[model samples]
Target chain A: MKTDWKFILQIFLSFLKIGPATFGGGYAMIPMIEREVVDKKKWIRNKDVTEIFAIAESVPGAIAINSATFIGYRLAGVRGAVAAMVGVLLPTFIIVVILSMLFLIVKDNPHIESAFIAIRATIVALIVYAAYKIGMTAVYDKTTLGIATVTTAILFFLHVHPVVVIISGIFTGMVAVQIKSWFGMSIKLEKDELNVVKKEKQVKEA
Target chain B: MDVLVELFLTFLMIGFVSFGGGYAMIPVIEIEVSNHGWMTTQEFTDVIAIAGMSPGPIATNSAIFVGYKTAELPGAIVSALAMVIPSLLIILIIATFFFRFNENKFVKSAFYGLRPIITGLIVYAAIKFAITNNVIGELSWHTASLMIIFGLSLFSLIKLRLHPLFVIALSGFVGMVLY
Candidate 1:
């Protein structure tokens, strides 16, 4: 595939333009990306956008960045992937760095300190809310509930590394499913179900 | 140079297991941040506030903030790249060979196990953060006000569905007024 500089530049600029709205990140950035990449640029079809999102969500890392790289790769291979990745990253990178600088400068101010006190409280709430949201989807069955409970217990009492816990989760999931199958039981991943529900809603809306 | 390498490697490790979105990565990031003695839990919460208010994924945003706090611009760049590099490589590999990686039964089972654990980790992250921030213990008017702020924040987020940025800004103003 002969990748033109102009095409790469277009990929970069399109993502860069979508970069600032990525404040909450993940799925929040999807509509905008779809607008720019599929609806506007016509670089890919609407159906391909759905496939990109499916893969992007399943993979590790931010969905926004993952989809960007996927879209770029589909269009122009490795170089296009790099172009899209850099493009999406650059705006937020600059903003965050500048914020870091500004934060360091005024952090010592008493008023700012007081404000941060409240902000910290809100941050905790945000995390709690995050857990609630994930829990709704992640903790559906008895086995899942057990996994979540044990994970918390291990974190609190055992003092193991979180990565260890995550790796354990992976292996545990695999083994658990295998055992369940031996008993002729089936496990349903809620995310797939969620996708189905979403598609149903989309169809209804259409 | 050694610090930069450590920063890169730390975030690279984080990037690999950072499933279930940026929030789920909080506990892992918190552990590394404290292990490196980069910041205190209180300070980490402040960093979270910054990351939450910023315009990107909290995982990468905090990585940039933590890296910058530790080793300046180079650190920020290295950490950011490290965080995303795994995503880039994994994505490319899947895009190339296993377009149906999501449909692989083994992969599906792995995620089946991973999902609840991700939820568990986030719950733990919340409790740990609250403990470190003194939200879980101690008693004072300060604590009382903080609780009120937290309650309101959670309400606004869940019930009202206000954007987090707006909630943060609102809480900051209330903090200034109260404190």
Candidate 2:
């Protein structure tokens, strides 16, 4: 419970070590983070990992960084949070900046241009796959399916800003839930989320 | 100097609304990049490709790249900080006061709408990327090859369960050979 430079640096170093491993996406890094914070360091309990991650996912920003900040804040304070955030950001920042610099230098090469051309195509596919994966969890019921459809249509046709869409989504959810409750219908938020979390826990345990 | 501030403020705004994590953040970033004239859509696609191949969240990685592209190292640092600052501050505020914040009923209801919209946002990002990259447009040898690459990449991702890094590497090789 002592908030000192050493403790803050400890948080920073711990997350700095975990930073590079966040390669693919935030969800995949969950177990690795749990291993470090829960099992090895004992900074938090095994039980709390899921809750922290859930909150992290629900909030803004990358889940990896968010959860790291949460754990660090839980351990120390604002300084710990900043340390852990910078810790997580530092490795990826350097790697990306290096990659960017290299990219800038070689981007005009014919071979490199060809490679990136194909890579761009592949990136589109990756984004589509991400949407499919999210859609499976997000578009469960009729209402959700409708929301997803309408949202896409709105984006495509209206050309509205994404932030507006998001704020609208929140109000739409709240209002829809209220209306559904009035009509004696039950609504579930993120139905698959719990199941997925449970499956991840089971996999981790196994 | 102005660009650094612009980079910071832009990413900071992005950080605030970045629910549902990195993929959801893409469409917003794409819009901002184009609006700011920081890079061409083609260049932005390359950034996404590199970010995907890199070892971090795509959103954060892309922010660093965009920042660097715009105003060099200082821009990169400022942008990365802006992206995460929202998370740090929001988590700190919630953790201190609202212990069971996720379980709050209105928050639950809000996510009900937000979740599907995030899905929509990601879907839009894919469509937008495909359009900008000429993936969805007319059929040429180049477009055809790109489509082929896209199909194989998606198949490998969903069915083969290949890591994205591997998939990307293979696609780049295919690109090198084909192009």
Candidate 3:
């Protein structure tokens, strides 16, 4: 894609604004990013945004950063990617430095302590809200919902490690699919097999 | 030899190993911060709160905040970059290769298997935060029953398409008034 510095600059500034102002994390920034990228700038379509989200989640990076890199690359190129990444990160870098300096100067203040207590409590609620939003989109099917519910129960009640729970969920999902196949009710494999047969028939006819 | 380089390397290791992001990085961060005499446990917890509430990913923000505390602007830059580099490299590799094998059943199965695991991780994070932060610890009947309210708020959020910020603000108001 050809570089569009004007569009790239606008996207960069938008992400910079979002990076500092947003609380919680990547999930918290979604609605605002949607407003800017999808509604205002029209840089990408809503469906593309959703697909990018899925791709971002499946990959290793911060979802927001990954999305920015992809969108920036698509709009411009490598330079755009660098611009967007720096934009998203710079505000956070500056703010954290300032906050740390201030904290050093007033670490023992009573008012600061109480304010943090309040903020911490509020943050718990915010994290819950973020999880709830992500869950709504990610858990679409009944099977997925069941997995989510069971996993949540295990983690909440049993105090399983988060890594362990994630690993187990992966195992459980695979086993569930295998069991469904054994019961002659697996739609996924059947669809794949049907596609193979159709492709073979077309080849023979040609 | 230099404290800045040491801090940078430490955060780089943290970024490489800390899977699932945010809350998942907490324990590793606690170990490094306390081990290096960089900050106290209380300070670490406070930084986590600020990072969570301020913006961006918790791990990256924490690296920046803690690094700055330990050294200066250079420390902050190196730490933040260190925290981000591993994940960025991995994502780029995956993005390049994923589509080529998108339709492969084994790959599909692996990812399908991973869905529940991710859910479990999130659930585990929520519970740990609740306990560590005293959100649901030794509660009275009134406070204990607040789970029901949380549940309803979440339900309304999904079904009614309400913005999460509003829900968070409302919960904060309720906490301020009631708690």
Give the top-scoring candidate (lDDT). 1
Q: Write the per-residue lDDT of candidate 3 for residues B76-104, one digit (tens) a residue.
A: 88888888776566655655554633345
Q: Where does candidate 3 chain A have its weakest 10-residue lDDT segment?
A: A189-198
List runs of model 1 lying over 4 Å from the truth: A196-205
Span of ten consecutive residues with least summed lDDT in model 1 chain A:
A192-201
- Write model 2 residue lDDT over B54-170, tens digit each, in one string: 887889999999999999999999999999888888898898895687888998899889989999989988998999888888989878888888999999999999999999999
* DockQ-based class of model 2: high
Sorted by lDDT, highest first, which candidate order results? 1, 2, 3
Cα deviation at B105, candidate 2, in Å, is 0.5
lDDT of 3 at A203: 63
> Which residues of candidate 2, in runs, are more than 4 Å off?
A192-195
Q: Which window of 10 residues has the lowest lDDT sum in candidate 1 chain B? A: B129-138
Cα lDDT tens digits for candidate 2, A1-206:
55589888888998889878777976666777788999899989988888888788788988888888898888888888888888877888899999999999999999998888889989999999999887888889999989998898999999999999998999999999999999999777667534455567878679
Candidate 1 per-residue C-alpha lDDT over B65-170 given as tens digits, one digit per residue, 9 for 90 to 100: 9999999999999999999999999999998895687778888889889999999999999999877776767898878888888899999999999999999999
Q: Considering only N, C-alpha and C atoms within 3 Å, which residue pairs clash in candidate 3?
A: A166-B117, A170-B113
Q: Per-residue alpha-carbon lDDT of model 3 for A92-183, expressed as tens digits? A: 77777776788778756665654544444444454565555445444656677777777777766775555455556546656777887889
TM-score per model (chain B): 0.96, 0.97, 0.60
Evaluated with DockQ, which candidate comes out highest? 2
